[model samples]
Target: MSLAARTLELLRDEGVDRVFGNPGTTELPLLRELATTTDPSYVLALQEFSAVSAADGYARGTGRPAFVSVHAVPGVSNALIGMNNARRSRTPLVITAGQQDQRFLRDAPMLGGDLVGLAAPACLTAEEVHTGADLLPLLRRAFARVRRQPSGPAFLSIPMNLLAADEDVPVPSRIPAPDAGPSPAVEEAAAVLRSAERPAILAGDRVGATRSVAELTALAEALGATVYPQPQYEYVNADSEHPLTAPSPHFTGTEIAKALAGHDVLLVAGAAIRPHVWTPERPIPDGVRVVQLDDDPAEIGRSYDVEVGLAGSVGATLAALTALLPGREADRERGARIAETLLRERTTWRDRARAGVDAGGPLDPASAAQAVADAVAPGTVVVEEAPTTGPALRRALVQRDAGDYHNSSGNGGLGWGAGAAVGLALAHPDRPVVGFLGDGSAMFGVQGLWTAARLGAPVTYVVVDNGGYRAVSDALPPGFEGTRLGGVDWAGLARSLGLHGTAVEHGSEIGPTLAAAQRSGEPSLVVVRIRGGAS
Candidate 1:
């Protein structure tokens, strides 16, 4: 078999059913093989950014490493932003870019830049394939590394000459995942939680990535502890509707300190407390005993000192802790009180959102988000990118499943949500997929709409057209120049890209329009106009 054929077979063996990419000259060989094969299909994107972001979403959806093949140097460069997002979220992905033939190295070919060096910053490992013999080994290593606990993106640069070569490489075995057993330190960690008057659990992206939210919920219930998902979490780490799942405070050291103030013991599971902005006060307050559980040991005690570090898989460790610390009457009573407080706070938020709807000029961010929450059906998958409206959206939308919600890695990258929405729709065809995007963020990856149209992916994009980059503009000093944006018709843009499109100028129209768009079962966009600046 040709090297390209063998590579496809290996990917199939490793559970990658589709390859997302925008092909070029160097990628033709693999593209040809993909054309001939039926098992592992190719999903083309208009740009490398869309391709990588699509793969990132697919990986998060399937709980497996996704495969992507892009053009050599420029393609790798185009893909870097999405790769950075993937790396930050620790999403498992195997990204390959085709390089120029080996014989042209001395000639300084157009696309002959060093792929490994360019991709290294965003990948766990990046290597160039020298010959056909080196192909399978490198591919195997990439798959293995990405599937291991604390999984992440890996990059491989394969030359066109090697891919076209008819060298008979050995059939590769399925890659093995590293053991995800709980650590022996779970006993000590449980002891700390059990002794504390108030225990708190912090869930992070890995909890959702590993499909361990159930275990997280179970452990929280067992200890009767309040659960808070990490700030800027890439996935739904806990069910939003769960009583123990409290809203995360504002992203600042002072707010985090205030929220976590009463907890005597904090279980840092698959998350490190991260604040969006720095402040003088520590995020984790003093005298709070910390018990950290993580598959990646490097994360344990990385920020604050920990009383016990449980290095293991999040699900296994949480399950072990739950087994060790059974529920008690006092714990149950405390949990009930916490649940009551959370319920009251949520009711107030809903009331505020309703008020926005009633007394509206342009829609408030909270009211617009509430409309989306009301429109989406149960089991719908929501992808978040509206930085201005996101907090309101989170509070309003209900996520009952681990994979029901996803968002950008919060690594300062903007174009991910548009393409990710397409990929997510493709991944979960049975479930509705909705993308809540800022008008500014949508423009960054707006080309993704064409791919969604071409593939017939059922996705509803809710663009909160607030006219500008409100999230950034809100932070800037008054009278700052060059940030304001307006005048583009988002619905017209979506229609031009071959999807059904509509605009909602009034607050009351938001929910009905979104509901209609989602029910269409075709890629569509609803541009909901709202007041601009500072949300």
Candidate 2:
């Protein structure tokens, strides 16, 4: 078999049913093989950003490595933003790009700039096969490495000429991921938690990535710990509406410090304390003892000093800790107190959200988010990229399922939500998907709507049209120019892309439009103007 044919066969063996990419001249060899294949279909994106982000979302939804094959140099560069986001979130993706023909290397051909060097910054591993016989082994290695602890994007640059070469080669046996058994420090971590007078847990995206939220919740309940999802987390760390849950102070070190103020023991579970802003206040409060648990050993004590570091599978370690610690029955009084505090905070936030919805005027971000939250279905998957609306949306929505929620990664890349929503819908056809995007962010990924329309993915895109890059403008000096955006017809753009599009004129229209679009089980877009910019 030709190398291209063998590559597809290997992908099929790995259970990758969809390959996402944007085509280029160098990629034609592999595309020819994909064109005739019935098992692993080619998912085309208008841009490389959408291609990579969509694959990232698919991997997150399916809990396996998703595939992407971009063109050589420019395509790889175009996909880097999404790649960085995937790397930060630890989404397993085996990304490949067709390099220019190896024969012209000394001549410095156009579109032949260093593919491996360009992609290495965003990939866990980036290498190029020197010969057709080496492609299979390189791919096998990438697949295995990308699924290891702290799983992330792995890249390979395959020469177009090599892919078309006819060579008989032995496919290497698949390397199975090693089981991360109980951590040696689980007992020590549990001892720290059990002895604490007041404790708080910092949960990360990996909690949901590993499908360990239940274990995390149980551990939280056992210790009566207030669980705070890490800032800019990519997945559901804990249920938003759970009584033990506390709001994340995303991007702000001072706010994070405030959240950690009263806790004596801070248990960091699969989370890194990397607040975006620079503030004098330390993220972890002074004199607080820290017990950090993560499947990736590098993440433990990565940003702060830790009293105990437990490196093992997040699910297994959390389960072991829960088993070692006293049950919820022992902490009934503390649990009740924490529940009351959370309930009171929730009530205040809801009241504010309700007050922000004025029928005669544009809705506030919280109100708009509340409407989307109200409209989501029971098994809905939500992907968020709205900077202004994120905190409000998190407060408004209630997500209980392990993988129900995801967001743009800490890399702070925009344009991820639309493609991610499409990928999620494709992965879970039975579940509706809602993508909450800031108008600015939506424009960055507008091309994804076409892919969604083509695939008929059931994604309801909620564009919170705040009239500008309000997140940036709000922080900039008052007279900063070029941040304000106006007069773009978002609904019309969606309609042009062949999805159901509606412009929400009032707050009352938001929920109904979203619900109807989701019910239709087709790609759709709802644009709602909110009180931001000059609005």
RMSD of each: 1.5, 1.4
The digit string of per-residue lDDT tens for model 2 on 196-249 reads 888899998778888899999998888888899888777888988889998887
Residue 83 CA displacement from its true place in model 2, Å: 0.7
Query: What TM-score goes with each of the models?
Result: 0.97, 0.98
lDDT of 1: 0.86
Q: What Cα-based lDDT does every candidate model obtain?
A: 0.86, 0.87
Give the Cα error of residue 278 in candidate 2, in Å. Answer: 0.8
Q: Lowest-scoring 10 consecutive residues by lDDT in candidate 1? A: 477-486
Candidate 1 lDDT, tens digit per residue, 24-105? 9998889899888777988989999999888888887777789999999999999999999888788889999999998987
Q: Please provide the root mean square deviation of candidate 1 (C-alpha atoms, Å).
A: 1.5
